[model samples]
Target: MEKQGQRCSGLVLVPCPFQGHINPMLQLGAILHSKGFSITIAHSQFNSPNPSNHPNFTFLPIQDGQTDHDATSTDFISLITALNVNLVFPLQESLAQMIKQEEKKERITCVIYDAIMYKAEEAANHLKLQTIVLVTNSAATRLTHFTYPQLQAEGYIPPKDSMLRDLVPGLHPFRFKDLTILNFPNLEALLQLIATTIKIRTSSAIICNTVDCLEQPFLAQLKKQYQVPIFSMGPFHKIAPPSSSSLLKEDTSCITWLDKQAPKSVIYVSIGSAASIDGRELIETAWGLANSKPHFLWVIRPGSVRGLGWRELLPECFKKAVEERGCIVEWAPQKEVLAHVAVGGFWSHCGWNSILESICEGVPMICQPCFGDQRLNARYVSHVWKVGLELDNELERGEIERAIRRLMASKECEEVRQRATDLKVKVEHSIREGGSSYNSLDDLVNHILSI
Candidate 1:
């Protein structure tokens, strides 16, 4: 064993078993590793990390107690329930063993876990480890979750299907209907989990993947509610080194396709990893893409369509119409695609990572948020930031066509383009030396060392 002074303390990161969650957590691990911390990733077996990809970090897979059948389920609520129950014991045992063996050298210092994976914090507390909660989405998203109790008390949730006119406090310009939860099997259970997680997380340092300039008001609100040190270190992917943590096999062929397109002429379309569009909606979207007639690169990942075979859903005429102008792939190298010169607008699900990436690339957007924090994200994209336009819930071919046209060719698109570009520069600067995100990273590192 190396001497205590010579050995770097270890940090265990517990990310929720999803692409979005895993990417940021791995990025954080890479960031911390660069800052002289020994990185150990304790993850669920549901979506296990390839240890080969990140050789520097030790990967610990805790049996999530999920059978092959349950593991294959797309029902996120059930999966997370199983994880919350099954992860506690294996993680406890793993942490206990690591602490026992590594205390003399490279001692385990802290467990910084995903906000959703609060069970890891419980395990860490049982082992007397310093814990921090890593909020993987925008601060605005967390702000909404934190304010759920108030919304529920005011009967603002379980919103009506009608276009809501009433506004939720702090979530202005967004109607009550926009606050609906997605894929949650039990609403009460989800609420309880959020409340409990927020309570537990408040006791420690909270790290968010958002910059101060992006969500200053929300961050300020969070500070007012909780006394813990809130570190807004983000565009985490920008600050951290480049690494491939994507669960899906990314198709880099889109890059070559983009090289042939005219500058600021292509629309990059991705609905995110987990969202499943209805068969009718898929057809509508296809027609919309065809009607818009812009050079487009669309990612139609397997399972994105609800039906068993979605390839044949689009009409032959629609397919033929887009054949000359569109490139369809299974998945995309999103960051590189967004940064490409040909990508002028993004038709996105408004996932926080996607939002940041789009902002980083100065690409305006047509927001088609599906669920969870995405609705709120869309609100901010369209209303708060004025970088995107949100689509209605019902996916109509005309609406889709209009949105693409508006974003790609409308005169008003210039203003949104300017705003997106401005934010891109600001976001880039924030990750540079002495900027808000840079300073926050330093403060977070020092806090972990102190603990």
Candidate 2:
């Protein structure tokens, strides 16, 4: 075991209390810990880390005064507001306690926080500690968040609810329909979050989980405008393997099921941690999956539907029909499942993590975006990268069946598959030795140490 005194320095990581945010922040922590840093995770009480999974890292669960069940009951904007209001003092107190105990042996050198949890940054600033903002989404999404005020002032937002295509200057191929944040029900609260997130300008540097090749233009513009150094050191999961901080117990059975299927023959469907579909849409999706007639592995989280007891609502006939060909689980070991030989196509919500993982595995996507960065990610997947097909808002069985067949069997899909494979090669190379992501990680480590 590595002794405390032998470690070079201590670092605190504050991830937002969400599965998507927690997983990447913990992966980054594991990567840094491998590089001689003493990893300390100071997380909110809501969605706290399972210490058993990360035994090496010191876990400090800062109280956000939220119960485990709050995740299902509380609305997103309210939860975010409560987190900012409640967690700051506990975070500062935790850092102070750590400093008092370990300062002589291994001082807490810096605090790396999720940019979404801007309150953590405020606390770090108040303590006069060095800080690095870890951005968990795409560079394009980050640009959207940062430039939201400009978009509002320029009269591009509060847009008509119809899907007419328009453009924002400097954000080409990203049309009015692609703007996700503005469509939120709580637009004011989201704008407030954006305003707070931009205070990341006060941090020592910004660490984003995106490679330059995928989002070069946004990264370039961000670098030129911001004084702080922006390090695009990712495809993060590849950099640190077997490093998942999932709040749910992933079903490993999916892997065993995948083993029996033919190569590149299964559609892997997962929407992500926090999207819920209405009753009609859920029924449509069920019919679509059944009509597609391809082998599939789908994740239907317990509360992913609007109605009570969603399991009872899935058509009995449809369930019986697909039982032989489809597998349904609450959650699966996603990275492992994606890399399985049987997964040829992804039916996804296009969360940044899922998108990168699919790209890494050379799997083409059938994009069905729900909210937030997903819309933009789908746009890029279908339009810019040409590695996926985007679904319309109306979830028709025919459209869904057609998309699956095209992605799985059509001649046009071969080109998409090849494009995804080529990008997979590029992604693999980026995280390898002396590549852009590798060099960026090295630079970030040095920058953190210097502070």
Q: How many backbone overlaps does candidate 1 show?
A: 0
lDDT of 1 by residue, 1-451 (tens): 2344766779899999899899999999999898889999999988898888898999999988888999878666677878977998899999999977885458897898987887887898898888998888877777678778777787766655553656877777666766746435678877877776677543369889999889999899888877789999998889888888999899998899899999999999899988879898888988888888898999999989987557788778887787769999999999999999999999999998999999999999999988888888898999999999989669998999888889999888998999999988898889999899999999998888777
lDDT of each residue in 1-451, candidate 2, tens digit only: 2365654688999999788899899999988988888899998877888999988999988988876666556478888878877898888888877767875667888999998788887788777888899989898987776667887888766777564476756788887777767468888787877777766557899999999889888899888767899999998899985766889989999999999999999999998988878788778888888988889999998788878666888878997889869998999999999999999999999999999999999999999998888889999899888999999668888899899989999998899999999999998889989899999989988898788
RMSD of each: 2.1, 2.1
Error of 1 at 10 (Å): 0.7
Note the clash tally of each candidate.
Answer: 0, 0
Report the error of model 1 at residue 5, Å. Answer: 2.8
Weakest 10 consecutive residues of candidate 1 by summed lDDT: 176-185
Clashing pairs in 2: none
TM-score of each candidate? 0.96, 0.96
Cα shift from native, residue 353, model 1 (Å): 0.6
